[model samples]
Target: MKKKITVALLTAAISLSLVACSNKENVSKNEKLEDTVVVYTTHKEEMLEAISDEFTKETGINVEFINLKGELADRVRSEKDNPQADVMFGGDTSTYMQLKEEGLYEKTEPQWKDELDKSFKDSEGYWYGTIKTPVMMFYNKDLLSADKAPKDWSDLTKEEYKDLIVTRDSLSSSMRSTVCALIENNIKTKNEDAAWKYLTDLDKNIKNYYNSGSVMYSAIGKGEAAISIAVLSDIIDNKENNKMPLEIVDAESGSVVITDCVAALKNAPHPNAAAKFVDFVGSAKVQAMIANDFNRIPTLDSALKDSPAWMATDYKAMDVDWDVIGKNQSKWIEKWETDIIDNNKVEKQ
Candidate 1:
């Protein structure tokens, strides 16, 4: 599906104008403005630009973003003495859990509190979930027809797909969290041995592990890898924008649904502007815009009703405790690196 440019045209225009008019010798008046919001986000550029532009248009406050794919929390903690960003956006709930534990965010009342589900937001409003990004697998459409594609996570262990699957390195926090969920939902729920056995078996088919999700998806799109695991949004964006021949498979066993959350720094340089930006992004209007144009599952109930037909509606969220996952993250990673990973490498060799 093509992006609906009509929703964010002025944002693109303003972004281009800012770039084209760059002059170190002569700083523009807008650059000199004091009330700008500095955003640290993991959102894709398109999503960031659109939301920022609309915030600028409505509040007359400029938005500057620093893209941090998976390290926003650590970066914010490092900059605690001198907060560089007013807000952090688009990391998953686990990211927010860490931030909340470390007291990195300020509790603020969001405009969409009533519209959002209680489970999706922090009880005290430290962070809020904006959209649902499900964990799923995709295959190269050119190489595998729909009927031939793997039906679920367990199917990935089949011998036919041996050395044909790719995924982000388990070292990455996002990938690690995904691994934890897979173990929790697919294996540990029934028995630990079953989960370990499944992961070890699946590892046999992993031909490569990518450092970045983008590179992994690119490999699958180019048919360099026939199958890969990724987020639903990434697959949609790649197929629509890059014309990548990819098709998504909702894990028939059940899929873990995670959300991209937004929060404001506890000691933000621009506190009021940060609050405004957060509220604007969480508002029904912007959430609806995201749902319609980008095919993301919105957190707002009203936005869900307004979402585009292409956006999925009937997928079951895996029953897992995010708090338990967040607390045991380090231990899980250690086990993965020592046991699961070590065993997989030896077997493949």
Candidate 2:
């Protein structure tokens, strides 16, 4: 009887030990997962790397990112069933809105949420803006005098500017936003026909549509083209850092200002890490650092105060409904390509 009782007690103790071991293993695995974050972004490699390095240094959380440029959103959509990234960063708010509508984001209220205006963040907390980007017209000062340069989107279609305008491919986010703004502008005036007509006329003057931003900037610097359109940050970078003779055109019709944003993916593998990263990147200190270092405009009201003086320069902002643009963007790009770009290619051939 005593021997049987000893055997039963030993067996029960062993069973409890096994359960404890299994629980420890799971806790270890979760801790490992929390130590790393995977990111997908449209930002340039240099900028992404720098920011990620800072994040890792501050939080001891590793950051592994893929720079997908214009392909980031589509990639996220394809990976919806099994998301490969914990976070998505650096696209305009319109792209984020579309993704949010598809239920692809994890709602996270970053620490800086209340520091920004309602327009800079999604109302339900799905995404938040990190920077402000104004899509503006630029001219090579050496090639075309300020007086002769196109002053507005409408002026680009003028006969005198023929064969002088160069632009990024339609797939570029900046170009897409600009086109959508044009469409929205005309739609508000109840003249959609005028928008299509304007695009067709502008297409006639385009010297070349380069697929690469570096190549396009090179062409402008080398006098291959005198006028172009790009985000303000790039224009400032080229003019100030690269010594390119580019100057911003104070477009009479105003620029389409886009709020570049960040969000965590739905069902991300590391939800806690994603939320922490989102908060870190959009914080006032980080936003100010980005604005000062990269020539970006900050979306945070407090961060804006610390930004460079040039960011304070006044420029007209076109009134735009980003949600409306987000819903119609894909179709508008398709129509632009099919009607304007393809037809022009056929004419040239």
The estimated TM-scores of all candidates read: 0.79, 0.87
Candidate 1: the clashing residue pairs are none
Report the Cα lDDT for candidate 2.
0.81
Q: Which stretches of candidate 1 lie over 4 Å from their true place?
A: 1-34, 145-148, 170-174, 190-197, 212-214, 239-245, 334-349
- Which runs of model 2 end up more than 4 angstroms from their true locations? 1-33, 342-349
How well does candidate 1 score on lDDT at residue 229?
78
lDDT of 2 by residue, 1-349 (tens): 0011121243242223111112223122444336666777777777777787777666666666776766778889988998767899988888899999999999998878997899899999999999899999999989888778887888988999988988887657788788888988878876889989888898899988876788889989888889999999899889988999888987887898988899999998778879888998999989898988888899887998999988887889988988888898888888988888744432220
Residue range 1-349, candidate 1, lDDT tens digits: 0122221242352233232122224233453433467788777688778887676666666677777665666678888877867888887787688778988998878767877888899988899998888877889989899998998888999999988888887545557768888777654567777877888888888877777677777678677779987777777778888888888787777777787889989988778778877888988899889887777778887887788765654665577778767766656666776777634332121
lDDT of 2 at 221: 88
